[model samples]
Target: MTGITDFTVKGADGGSVSLADYAGQVLLIVNTASKCGFTPQYAGLEALHRDYAERGFAVLAFPCNQFGAQEPGDAAEIASFCSLTYDVTFPVFARVDVNGGSADPLFDRLKADAPGVLGTKAIKWNFTKFLVDRAGHTVARHAPTTKPEDLRAEIEALL
Candidate 1:
């Protein structure tokens, strides 16, 4: 099966990151935006990372500008803002489009694996999250309104 570990994503440094590197880890993959109303969710996401990392859990962030031009910064700028503003330690990837023809293939697979409300394949907004189990199976798709902390029990179950 074409799981998340089958894809290669762009790193913040413009390098390719093999998703295989994260194999066996429970992942909360999120599309983020610095200027969005849900920006503060970064802290909650970081908390999830810090709290559950030793248990093989992680939060992988991908900044996207496709939603309202909310993330207009470059890679460096995005990295700096994430560090200075939220002190996030999780892996924050390069900017990407999460919907439409230009969407990243990883996200495309994620959306296909676990469609949103009404079986929608397109990501609706920034901070949309996909939870993946250790086997790389997409477990759930969360909307921007779902708080990170609210996922603790689900993550713990996978761990």
Candidate 2:
């Protein structure tokens, strides 16, 4: 019975925020890394957030260090890097393990709801994205190689 709105994520400032706060909004949840090869995807993500946020869409980023230690920085450093490097305005939560035993519960639910290629649920790498509809059901899963901008049509369709 668990859905996206039933989950809560740690805010960048260390407080807990329920996904329900984003109720009625389409969500694009991403596992992000500061120094990864896909780091530049932040710009595209930010663009999406800017373009559709007012129209009931949002981009929620969760920094993950589980891959090659690409995101070794603490919350402050990660926030600074995201702001300075990509001018990101969307929510970027505290670092989380997107895979393995220590994975965040929200991500666990995301993967379970929208399994990736061949029904595999574990996120293969950072930048992996899950699209959720307004009612909090995960609709699709995108691989790390999928660019943020490339999902515009899907997002628009949901809108």
TM per model? 0.99, 0.98
TM-score of 2: 0.98
> Over the full model, what C-alpha lDDT does candidate 1 score relative to the true structure?
0.96
lDDT, residue 30, model 1: 100
Q: Rate the local accuracy (lDDT) of all candidates.
A: 0.96, 0.94
lDDT of 2 by residue, 36-116 (tens): 999999999999999999999999999999889999999999999999999999999989998789989998888888898
What are the clashing pairs of model 1? none
> Which lDDT tens digits does candidate 1 get at residues 24-126?
9999999999999999999999999999999999999999999999999999999999999999999999999999999999999999999998999999999
Report the poorest 10 consecutive residues by lDDT, candidate 1. Answer: 1-10
Note the residue pairs that clash in candidate 2: none
